[model samples]
Target: MPITARQLLQIFPNAGPVAGVFVPALNEAMARFKIEGRLRVASFLAQVGHESGQLRTVVENLNYSAEGLVKTWPNRFSRVSAAAVARKPEQIANIVYASRMGNGPAVTGDGWKYRGRGLIQVTGWVNYQACGSALGLDLLTKPELLEQPGYAALSAAWYWSKHGLNELSDAGHFLDIGSIINTGKTGTAPHGAAERKALYDRALQVLE
Candidate 1:
């Protein structure tokens, strides 16, 4: 059966003020991308719900005015070893100042550039531009709009279309969505692919 707007709201009851904004957009995106079937809908919603905290954390720290990706400071290897890190007072102050000033995530070779945003957690400037182009929106110019529900929906649909979601069997690689959203890695992970697949299967069964 096809997923409906009511189902989404039921799945995420406490969506708050953004419920009005997200529901219609989600319906539109699902339809636009021809994402039919209850399983796919449930999986997509589950991933987005987990990522955005049911739409409350859409713009990170409620900083819709935030221009671009703002990630934590890098460690000695210049890698984002941890998602949330304890920062020194000066570092915390600098991050705040830079974010307000629209400095965005520093374009280093480091992997920190890909934080999270949009419905699918669109990351990196290249991805932002690609998704924006796919949806006929200039994300590079107005990157902050990814935080907006409407734009976020469009970007996610674009990603789903581009990533060939319709081609893969939902049950075969259910963790693909989670990997895509969380780590920006697609398909399966090298070390824990089997474990991830098991978890995905369990979640899908419960959702269904």
Candidate 2:
């Protein structure tokens, strides 16, 4: 069954103006990804809820404190280096995202340009290019388009489909789905794992 805007609002409550974009995308993605069951919808909603903060924003926030940098991106910043760039959103984005995930050096500006956006925080240049191509959007040149509500939801659905999350959802593997969305690098203790799971539980009640 296709989800209604009323149902989405029941769960999210604050989806606000994005409700128009979100509801249609949810139904379309669910069908395209073959997410037929209520469990599947619940699982997808849970992860997207956590990733997009209930559809509040599509862009990832790069405003980090020194401590946040150390905790969030230890591989990119040390205590001294993090303190130097603390609270600098753009600079921090350029530095932490530099030279990885198919991005060039800081001067290339691909880091900040291809920074996380969309409902599921799609990062990396290669991913943007691929997702854009799949969705018929020129995301490489206009990365900000992913921040728009329609593309934000569609891009997330595309990512979810690409990762075969529908099968995981069918199997009721909520944590596994979360791990995949978290970049396939965390365990039960992954950041926001608990919150994601909590959202899943809540979504089950609302969706079911």
Candidate 3:
């Protein structure tokens, strides 16, 4: 069941500029990642839609206000700490992402260098290295490549396939899938689980 550019646009109307690129990338990725089943296709497209905001943004938004920081990363940005780094995406990325996700300490610049990118927001040095190796892109040297339309779709599909999301989709364990995709209280009812599920159903309507 190969998806067409027209069908893709039916679901994602704003994918105008990159439709020529995205449709082919997605079709290629489907074959590479074995996204064979209907559920897998719907789930994959739905998650990518939610994460990338209907294919509008490939990079993560790091510009956080003090209040946003406190709400988003309370542990990292206490009231006092949030104020200091408010509206500073680079500084916030350095502080909050420091020494984690295979990143170096705050002073090493690994945080900003490997900030979240691609359709699924691949974060950290380890992720870049692995996804890069899988895609043969040398992302460690040119992390910005993830922002490209083809690479963004490929990287996200790689991540989805690597994580065995197809199995989850087959088993109808969407909540478990959400847990893996995001950090939320429950695997099934995470922060954006409802929206993800809704989109999944919508995509299924089109894909089926």
Candidate 4:
């Protein structure tokens, strides 16, 4: 079932005009990915809502404080190291994300170039390549295109569909869905697990 702007707002009241703007794109993406059933739709919307910050921030914010850097990636950032790179979004991106997720070495700048974007944060070169291929977009050349509402919504729905979230949703194993997407410890909460669950509950109620 296609969600009305009113229903979306009910789930994400802080979205303001973004709810209406995303309705078409969201519906299109969901339909394309077969994100049907109340459970599936609610799970998709809830997770997307949290990740995108109520449809407001589609791009990943890499700005980190020294303490934040240490907390977010303890293995990568000692106090001294964190302080050195603190508040440097590009440098932080290059350092923490370096040599992983299909990114080149820190000096290569691929990490900063491919920092997370889109509603679901289609992160890294490998993911961008796959998602771009699926969506027929030239994301390698224009990575920022994921910030656009259409691609943002579509990419998120595509991720949800591809990752088997629909089955998790059907089972109402919402936290597992988050952990899987975050690719974090299974059965344990993912980052922002509480917020994700809260959003899921709100979406379930609103979608009903």
TM-score per candidate, in order?
A: 0.64, 0.92, 0.93, 0.96
Which pairs clash in model 1?
none
Q: Give per-residue CA lDDT, model 1, range 1-208, as digits (tens).
A: 3444555556666676676678778878878887667566655666566666666775444222112223332322122422232333223333433332233543332123233567776765567668878888777667778878888877777777787765553564566766664555776543344543443344355447
- State the TM-score for model 4: 0.96
Candidates sorted by TM-score, best first: 4, 3, 2, 1
- Candidate that would win on TM-score: 4
| Reference-based lDDT, residue 74, model 4 | 97
Error of 3 at 148 (Å): 0.9
Q: Candidate 2's residue-wise lDDT over 1-208, tens digit each?
A: 6888888877777787777667887787668767778887888888898888888979999989999999988888999999999999888988978888899999888888999998899899999989989999899989999987778878888898899888888887778888888866435454588888888787788876
Number of backbone collisions per candidate: 0, 0, 1, 0
The clash number for model 4 is 0
Which candidate comes out best when scored by lDDT?
A: 4
C-alpha-based local distance difference test score of model 4: 0.91
TM-score of predicted model 2? 0.92
Residue 77 lDDT in model 4?
92
Q: Rate the local accuracy (lDDT) of all candidates.
A: 0.58, 0.84, 0.86, 0.91
Model 2 misplacement above 4 A: 185-188
Instruction: For residues 123-198, write the lDDT of model 3, one tens digit per residue.
Output: 9999999999999999999999999988998998899888888998999888887788886334446667888888
TM-score of 1: 0.64
lDDT of 1 at 200: 38
